[model samples]
Target: MAIRNVLQLGDPGLRVVSEPVADPGAPEIAALLTDLQDTLTHWRTTTTYGRGIAAPQIGVPLRVIFLHLEQPWPLINPTIIAHSEEQMVVWDACLSFLCIFCQVWRYQQVDVRYQDLQGAWHTVHAEGDLAELLQHEIDHLDGILALDRMTDIRTMCTREEFEKRYRERSPYAR
Candidate 1:
């Protein structure tokens, strides 16, 4: 597993919609899951901001995502099977976006169906931050972002405000 460079906003590769892994059991897909896990671990140790990562974020054009809670768990060819009727709004900041965050509406809960790194299938019913993160990462695979999910772009914070709110993690000063 290697620590792959995350693609920036201007990178054309990020715009490409990822292709689904038809055979989640294939070695190539398995290797991708391993790499995703490595990135999850690398960011956890290096940045202290490892939570969720999408393949598209790392320039991998596959329908793969890693949702590493405090524990490392990989989601390969993930699909959201169900979601709560109730919706909630949260401030979302992408690793790709650095300091920027937008108020995005998402379901309060989501039932996810995905394959594990070992190619075994599993189902997860999650709410709150986990649900929000799944929706967010899946959005990335579909070439979408928090900005796109927001009802109003005006609600998004100015860079100054964003930096003030997330002072330590803000990349604006960089």
Candidate 2:
């Protein structure tokens, strides 16, 4: 398993809706999950951004998502099984979109149906930050960016400005 370059926003791969993993028990699927973990680790260590990644971002058009919450969780072919009427809006950024951030509406509490790494079906309910991040990553599988779902996109910044302001890169903006 190797970490792959995340496709940028303009790439056709980013727009292609991913296909679900045919066999959750397949070896390649497991490897893809590993790579997704790598992608998550890259972002978590290299930036103060996110803790999850979707397959499309890493050049794989599979309906797969790697969640790095308390432990590494692989959500293969996940589907939103249930959603609450309660809505919440949170500032979100996509790895493929780089420095751009947007606010999106998501169910405050969501029950998702997904298969685990061991090919067992699992249902989990998430709220707050993890819920928001999970929903954002799942959107990637559907070829939807946070920008597209953003209600009011007022706060905007280029990669250079964001990096400088967040001390992510060269702190020359000061």
Candidate 3:
């Protein structure tokens, strides 16, 4: 278990679609989860902004997402099975794109089917911040970024500019 380097924006690896994990309980998958935790923890301590990370972010082409919201939650091979019609536009930032934030619209609610570390399947109904986080991390599995979801290129701004111009309007502002 180590704090693997997070792939940055424009890194070819970040654009590759990750492969499905055949065995969630595999030793390697456990190690990958540990690496993700170590890396995400490091990022949060340094940047005070990371909530979750995908395996692809650490150059691992696997469908795995590690979220540290109120607790550590690992979703393996997660798929959005359902979503609400309601949507919300949010100012989203990615560790891959460290300093840039982009405006993107996401479902207000979603039902995701995923496997656990024990290789057991489960479905989770997520709304609000959890829904958005799941969608963002899942997008990484499909080689997409928040930048690709922007409705207007002008909506993209640097972190500093976001704080100065859009923080008051951003639900994610902390």
**Which candidate tops lDDT?**
3
Candidate 1 lowest-lDDT run of ten? 165-174
The residue ranges of model 2 lying beyond 4 angstroms of the native Cα positions read: 158-174
Question: How many backbone clashes are present in model 1?
Answer: 0
Q: Which tens-of-lDDT digit does each residue in 133-170 have in candidate 2? A: 77888888999888888878665556655565543432
Candidate 3 global TM-score: 0.95
Give the least accurate 10-residue stretch of model 2, judged by summed lDDT.
Answer: 165-174
Positional deviation of 114 in candidate 2, in angstroms? 0.1
lDDT of 2: 0.78
Off by over 4 Å in 1: 158-160, 163-174
Candidate 3 lDDT score relative to the true structure: 0.92
Q: Would you list the C-alpha lDDT of every candidate in the order shown? A: 0.78, 0.78, 0.92
A best-first ranking of the candidates according to their TM-score comes to: 3, 2, 1
Cα lDDT, model 2, residue 63: 91
> For residues 54-130, what per-residue lDDT tens digits would candidate 1 score against the true structure?
99988888889987765767787788999999998876767776556677899999998888756788999989878
